[model samples]
Target: MAARSSHLSLALLLVMAVGCAAQDYDFFYLVLQWPGSYCDTRQSCCYPKSGKPAADFGIHGLWPNRDDGSYPQNCNPDAAFDPSKVSDLLSELRANWPTLACPTNDGLRFWGHEWEKHGTCAANAFNEHGYFQTALRLRDQLNVLDALTSGGVSPDGGYYTLGQIKDAIKRGTGFEPYVECNRDESGNTQLYQLYFCVDTAGDRFIDCPVLPRGRACSNRIEFPAF
Candidate 1:
């Protein structure tokens, strides 16, 4: 009896060790949107059914625009993400934050799905937090709109009080624009860039590959919501 108990304890310890190590090497990238117009439910896992706040953009998976020079097809949400086997890394990566919160009981179905398919949400929580760093850059565009009613703010400092923030995106001040990642001509991972410039007249325009928001701002600020 004593020997059996000792063996059981050893097995339990080994299992615990394995679980911890699994989480350590697990590097995940949240995809804000999948290719085309569909959200890959198999890869979205950050938020549950509680309904994400207006400001939260779960995770946008990797965008492959530069890879084939053409947008990729939508992902099949039922695809699996392997937690074990390092060799399956890429496959799992294709579904990092897998979810089952959609109204459809079949597969990839959830609230964030719609926003992500359109490249509206953040690629991950980290990306969302980064946007807040330079709140001022977006404040001019994000402020006036009633996030719940108005889609968002207008570019000319005009307020919209009855639409979705996605719609309000048209009102952006163009300081910190969205970014697009793809491979370069040299076949290397490259980040396309876009910057904000305050002209002599104090005007800004949306430019090239936008950088991750709040990353360039030297000052840090907190965004409560919207």
Candidate 2:
């Protein structure tokens, strides 16, 4: 009876360790938001405290996703956000990841949520500062606006075929992206978000799996003007 109890305790310890290890994510989903579509759909958009962001796709969040199309979030309960850790990268974050929510457009709150949820899951691979810096660097490399415009898919309230949008992004990043859209008041579907899959190291882009949910886009999508 004593030997069985000791073995049971060891087994329980191993199971707990495995559960904790599973919290580390396998890859990243770099999500970007189009301000034009966001504001148009929401019908109310405000900029960050700093000022209005440029008419471009902003970084929404860099989430950690698993192979099964699921993602780990809020992995570390004790992971309190420390703004000072990312102070050096604030300027770039403000420019690229501005909060577009209305009534109270606070970038800090957005960042805090992102860090606590997604960033904590990736803490094993990257510290707080590293997680944010990696996202900024990835965003700089993937210029969605330039890619679409250069491919004759300008954002002048014009509708572009889904093929054109995907082709342009693939041509720009050398990897296909996941396109999502939202509808405006006029009932027209507009480009909303773009997501690119990245490896666990956060160094290179990878082809994303078929998303678990259907994409929020029509065959034709409007890249609404901001």
In terms of lDDT, the best-performing candidate is: 2
Q: In model 2, where do residues sit more than 4 Å from their true spots?
A: 1-23, 210-215
Which 10 consecutive positions of candidate 1 have the poorest summed lDDT? 217-226
Off by over 4 Å in 1: 1-55, 67-69, 72-80, 83-101, 104-175, 178-226
Candidate 1 to truth, TM: 0.23
Task: Show pairs that collide, candidate 2.
Answer: none
Residue 69 in candidate 1, Cα distance off native in Å: 4.7
- In lDDT terms, how accurate is model 2? 0.86
lDDT of each: 0.30, 0.86
Candidate 2 structure quality by residue, lDDT tens digits, 1-226: 9999999999999999886775566778899999888889647688778888899989999999887878788989898788899999999989998898876565888899999999998876799999899999999998888888888888899998899999988887787788888889888899989989888889988887645353568888999898
Cα misplacement distance, residue 80 of candidate 1 (Å): 4.7
lDDT of 1 by residue, 44-145 (tens): 224334333233222333232211223322233332222232232323222332333445332234313432331222222223223222222333333322
